[model samples]
Target chain A: GAGVSQSPSNKVTEKGKDVELRCDPISGHTALYWYRQSLGQGLEFLIYFQGNSAPDKSGLPSDRFSAERTGGSVSTLTIQRTQQEDSAVYLCASSPGLGPITQYFGPGTRLTVL
Target chain B: GESVGLHLPTLSVQEGDNSIINCAYSNSASDYFIWYKQESGKGPQFIIDIRSNMDKRQGQRVTVLLNKTVKHLSLQIAATQPGDSAVYFCAENLHSGGGADGLTFGKGTHLIIQP
Candidate 1:
């Protein structure tokens, strides 16, 4: 079966610009999550989207970071007015349902804010 | 064991030797723990997982141990190989009524395999 996939492998943008990263979870996956990883650091929780309820934005660092999972399939993470600190690897993961929390990840998009 | 803001801790081990990586989680409420292996230029790959109920679980060559008493978790790989060189991360999740809560990850440890 095809695993989770992400777009643009890499992205380079200027400061203050906005960038969008896409994620395609495996077929039938009902839960999606977005995370950020800094160099030599751990994965930081950003947002989570379940079947249909309101997304969990608690881990979002700021209002600029927003994500939307359209039709419960693909998810897009948008960073508005990006900053140097936003330069990191944006990773996406998905799970079959969610109760037990077993997730599979995508290759991720390395975003560079210059 | 665990790191704060500094760079990820490094564990150097010789090939064919057993390597054990440790993690100290902050949340005692977490009921599930997962270990992931991330190589350079790639996303994290799931290694093994353990639930709070069981103190230990084993995979092909990997074992995950969870100690709820001390809020600690450890991953032990039997007979490490060169391909095992990568960053290992321990993630914790508390089933907060919401089944799909985001995971809280530890700082991760970089494993260096030497021949």
Candidate 2:
């Protein structure tokens, strides 16, 4: 079985630039989630998408963070005007459906804002 | 705000010994709990999960215990191996009326297995 996948395993960008991270969830998975992990820190919830329902953006730290899942399969997390504080690993996960299901994670994309 | 927290930042155990990690959550509304293992340079991998109804659940060589009264959760690994060394996280899920919310993760405990 194929697991969740992410692109650009490592990305180094200049401050104020925008970066988009992509996630491809497992086939047939209806629930997707995004999280951020800073160096030596715990994971922070970012956004969530389930099927066609309204996405949960409550965890997005600021207006600069946004995400969208097209056709209920793939998701893209975009960070506008990236800052040094945005340097961290962006992780994506997906589950079979929703409640109490296990989320399979992708190898995160490490963004380094220089 | 409600949160989940780990009792220890790191635990060192010898190979073949048992290891236990503890977590305390403040949100009683959280009905589901899970444990994840993250190795360096990789994303978190689901280890096991336990629901609010049951007090304990067992998986291959692993057991998850939940205490709703004390809002406590513990993960026990039998005969811990060197390959088990990683940062372990405890996450809680709050099922909002509308839909499921993102999990609230606790600061992980680094498990160090000494051979």
Worst 10 residues of 2 chain A by lDDT: A50-59
lDDT of 2 by residue, A34-78 (tens): 999998878898888887554567789999998998998988999
lDDT (tens digit, per residue) of candidate 2 on B6-89? 999999999999999999999998989999999999999999999899999999999999999999999999999999999999
Model 1 stretches astray by more than 4 angstroms = B1-8, B98-100
TM-scores of the candidates in the order shown = 0.94, 0.97
Give the candidate number with the greatest DockQ: 2
Which tens-of-lDDT digit does each residue in A47-92 have in candidate 1? Answer: 7888655446778889998888889899999999999999999999
lDDT (tens digit, per residue) of candidate 1 on B4-111: 121339999999999999988867777788999999999999999998899999999999988879777899999999999999998887767644387778878999
Please list the residue runs of candidate 2 whose C-alpha ends up more than 4 Å from where it truly belongs after superposition.
none
The residue pairs in collision within model 1 are none
What local lDDT score does residue B9 receive in model 2, on the 0 to 100 scale?
97
